[model samples]
Target: MRLSRSFLPTLKENPAEAQITSHRLMLRAGLIRQTSAGIYAWLPAGLKVLRNIANIVRAEQDAIGAQEMLMPTLQSSELWKRSGRYDAYGPEMLRIRDRHERDLLYGPTNEEMVTDLFGQVVKSYRELPQVLYHVQWKFRDEVRPRFGVMRGREFYMKDAYSFDVDYDAAVDSYRRMMLAYLRTFQRLGVKAIPMVADTGPIGGELSHEFLVLAPTGESGVFFDGAFEEQDWLSEAVDISDRESLAKFFARMTSFYAATDEKHDEAQWAKVPPERRREGRGIEVGHIFHFGRKYTESMDISVSGPDGAPLYPEMGSYGIGVSRLVAAIIEASHDEQGIIWPQSVAPFAAVIINLKNGDAQCDEICERLYAAAPEHLLYDDRGERAGVKFADADLMGHPWQVIVGPRGAKAGIVEVKNRASGERSEMPVDAVLAHIGVGA
Candidate 1:
């Protein structure tokens, strides 16, 4: 993508309303714009990052055999009524009325709707174990929506529903999702710790919220320091093997981890003094096993082997796809701007034409741009060298390749690593090679 022709409306100063670093940086970097109190319009650069994060989440979900599907943003309130939550889910639910005066709502979550769908078509135990997921927009009317997209009223989410015949089978499905979530966050360059959490309106005894530690977080969390060192990605997991799944579950749950709501002082005392860790964290993902909660309410039943009618056990998993953008920035940014991980970076490398109109610089930048990877963004805008450099840093591309008059004359370019702030002058071909795009 060429910056000169792109719709990146970067700001010269921070927006006064943005209270957090991620929110402020997102505005200054031209990633998003607030259309309302908590609703945002993602610009070109921000949309690219959003899509990248969505793809990673999709891939990880697929790895665990979860089939992807799309669900509607608006749902019939009748479905929630059937589940007895139409009235229970108050203010946060965006209630509305259609022409016929029927109650409708922009779904905050999809438990009741998915349960109704499952009850209609799935009647036999043969379809007992199925994981279905969708990436869609959701709306919740937050009384005080602030901190940019981090706590937005309208945001994108990846929600999955799992159906099983019984409690044991449902637990296995939950374990699979836990593992998938861990791997997903790891690939995105964040260490998310799974802590027992309140089910809230979802209503279940078993629930976990994955929190990423960040100084700007809203929730206080306590956990064993060992959680910081554990590598969930290295462990082998067999989703279909119940014994293996149980072992993994035991290993992870054995740790002392809980959010403030669930934290116990007695439990903290049990751990060695050096292993205790208390800090602020951002909630990025949540999962719950609500056995028969939705299925029974919605009449989602399957025939057992003994030919008895039984309600299917179910669980729901959610990841805040849009909120992750803010979370990533919150956890990784420096004074300059965001430090995006390569997996979720909008652009892998940025090509800066330091001397925009200079013939030699233009020739080198154009050549590199032609050979650059599809993920690279070429900054050929007619801006000063300092401005171009600052923009490149603010955008937080993993690498920056600067083509200036002096460097072009010597057949060299300055290659800089955004995260390390390290730079070295190399032959133009070498710079291309360093970016993994050989000339």
Candidate 2:
């Protein structure tokens, strides 16, 4: 992870095609590169961030008892046809034909495929409640894919499917996902408000879109200001207790929040003017309670207690795993560059050898690098101190430990907080302690 040997291709000037802060910073910071209109190749630094985000999503999903299992990027078009969506999905679906002329597609979503799988194996109500998720690449042919990964045609997503025997059970599954999404965003250092949203092609009457407030966000959202103050993490989550889950559900639904598609002027006007907040927001996650939509269409049925054949109620939850990289930048960057949250930061800290070839600086940086975690990126490049500092800021590591000639000679180093712009000169051992690395 030495910067001198790393593949970070930071740019000095903003790329002209980047219309948003996240897009510009992503390019300038060398996190990603556009391979096509909306497809990107994640470089080393970008891939680290992507993995970090995926890990967070995985942890939160696991907390709610959702099992992780990857689905394929390419799916047979027959699956979509079985669900009656092959024709309905239209242009966004990347339709293709194999050499033998069999229809195929890069799956935009996995509802139909998951349903088909569920129907084959899960027949009894004993397996009534199940949540399976995957972090995988998805393709959607956006007519105008712009804003970097924020609206990319090819992107990574964490999509989960929940199957339950009936509507009531499905609602519970939706609540679990809602809580998991809140916890996921909270751990990522972002406040995402759950707003009622249109189900769109997913075709669900009950749906919630988790939106993170950002000036450059595409969706206009309105909500009660109280949502900003609510701490979803502090509330106890008892998924096994139905009453407790219902209580949590009640608390979340009490808030008045809606995206443009679900906005009601009369309901919004009812809020006191001071409590009303209208702002642009990025949709980071969505959950749907689509009772029997995919299951019935795809013949996914389970045996009821009364021995009747019944289609399982279903829900799908999605998090924009790749888009979150851009969303985080949009919500947290300053003029210098991205200020990554520690949880999702590619590197917790960057060690900058301000005087690269200087013996003392090199010694100090090398020592710190040896002790730091594998994720730490040591900037051992022979670049100017200013350039190194600027690049460190642009790359958005949560902290920067500068081993300058002066500090190195003094047996000290300067630890700079990327977000606060605060620098503290301390003994090398203290620097190690500050960064949670043993000397």
Per-residue lDDT for 1-439 in model 1, tens only? 8988889888778889989999999999999999998999999889998999999999999999999988899999989988999999989999999999998999999998888887788888987798989999999999999999999999999999999988999999999999999999998988889999889999998999999999888888999998778776677888889999999999999989999988899998998999999999999999999999888887778988888998888999999999999999999988888899988998889999887788999988888888864778899887888898888888899999988898899899999999999999999877766866544
**For model 2, what is the alpha-carbon lDDT of residue 74?**
94
Model 1, stretches more than 4 Å misplaced? 437-439
Minimum summed lDDT over a 10-residue window in model 1 is located at: 430-439
Return the clash pairs for model 1, or none. Answer: none
Evaluated at residue 438, the lDDT of candidate 2 is 56
Candidate 1's TM-score reads 0.97
